[model samples]
Target: MNAIIVTGGDIDISLLENYIAENKEDIIISVDAAITKLEKINLIPHIMVGDFDTLSDDDRLKKYAELDVEIVKHDPVKDFSDSELAVDRAVKVGIKNIAVFGALGKRFDHAFANILILQKYKKLGVDITIYDKYNKIYVKSNHFILERGKLWGKYISFFSLEEKNFMEKLEGVKYPIENRIIDNIATPSLYISNEIKGDKLKATFSGDLLVVESRD
Candidate 1:
C-alpha cells in the first residue's frame, strides 16, 4: 500500500521501527524532533520538514542534508504548527494514504489539534491516521467496515465529530446503535472496547465518525 509516515519526535523508536518495517516502501516524513528518531535508528527519511529550533545538533541536520533527503525548512514564527508543516509536505508528495506517528501522546493539545487537522485531509480524499504507543486514531466516512484487527490488543471506539448522526449503524459491539444521530461534540461514552464478532462490522453514518483503536 502507498503510505506516508509523518514523525513528530514523541516516538518510541522500537515501536516506530516495528510499524514501519512492514511499510518499508512507504515514504518517511520526519518533523522537528521526530527526525532524531530516524537518526537514532540509522535510517534516512525521504522528507524532513519543520523549524530546526528543537534540533540543536548541527551535525545531525547536516548529515541528512548531505545524504540528499528533501528538507523543507519553515519559519518558527509561522501560523501553522510543525506537524502541520510535515503533513503539508506529505500531501505535496501526493500520497493518498498517511500514517502519522508521535503526533499523539507527546502532548494533549497536539493530539486534540491533530483531530481538527483531520478535517482538512478529508476533502482531499486522503486517509490519514494518528498513531501512538497505545492508540491508533482515525476517522471513517459515512460508510465503512470494522473487521477484527489482524493483530491483538486493538480495541475500537467511535465518536461523532461535529455531526448529529454519528453512529448510524454499529454492529458486533456490546452496545450497538442503529441509525442514530449524535452531536459533533458528544462524548464517546457508548462506543468503547467493542469487539467484532462476525466477518465484518459495518457502520454507515450521515456525518464524520471518529474511530479510536486502543491497544491493550
Candidate 2:
C-alpha cells in the first residue's frame, strides 16, 4: 500500500486535504507537530512518529493516545530527523511507495535532508517523493516517462546526483538532447526548465537523476 508522511514543515492546507482525499486508502503518518495540522482538518493518522520535542500539547497527544493511534517515540538525542524516522517506520512496514508532504519549508537544512532521503531509500527499492505546493521532487535512475497532463508542474528539471558524468537522452520535450554528457558541476543548467512538447516526455540516463517538477 502507498504511504503518506506529514512532517513539521510549511504545508498548504488545501493541497494536503486534496491529496489525502485522493488517496484515502493510503496509510497516513504524522511527524511531531504535524499531528496538529492533521487534527485541525479532523483527520487522524494511522502512525505518529517523532521525538516529541516539537510537540507541546500533552492533551492532544493524550487524546490521540485514547484514539489508539500508533505513536513511535524517539529520543531527543537521536541521529536522524523526525521525517527520516517516519520514513523508516513506513519502510519497515513494507510500504514501498511513500509520498512526503510538509517536507519543504523555512528550514533549508531539513528540506535538503528530506530530499536526500529520496536518494537513500531509493537504493533499497523504495520510491519516495517530496511534495510541496509548487514542487514535486524525486530521484530516479535509468529511464522515466512523464505523461503530458499528469505532471505536477509545468516545468521539469533534471540534475545529476552522481560525481561522474553520464550520458542522457531526452525526447518529446521542448529542448531535446541526444546522448549528451551531463556533469552536475559542469552543466548545472543544461536540463532545466524543459517543457513537454507533445503527449509525453521520456528520459533515459546512465546516472542517478534528481527530477524536480516545479511551477511558480
Instruction: List, in order, the clash count of every candidate structure.
Output: 5, 0
| lDDT for position 199 in model 1 | 63
Query: Model 2, residue 111: what's the lDDT?
Result: 93
lDDT of 2 by residue, 52-98 (tens): 89897778788888999998889999999999999999999899999
The residue pairs found clashing in candidate 1 are 9-34, 162-184, 164-182, 165-181, 168-179
Model 1: residues >4 Å from true position, as ranges? 151-154, 184-188
Least accurate stretch of 10 residues (summed lDDT) in model 1? Answer: 146-155
lDDT for residue 72 in candidate 2, whole number 0-100: 89
Off by over 4 Å in 2: none
Q: What's each prediction's TM-score? A: 0.90, 0.97
lDDT of 1 by residue, 1-216 (tens): 455565563677788888789788898888877776777878788888888788766787788889998878888899988887777777776777888888776578877888877767876788888777787778777888766654234577777676555466777665677867666456547566776666667777776777787877
On the 0 to 100 scale, the lDDT of residue 176 in model 1 is 71
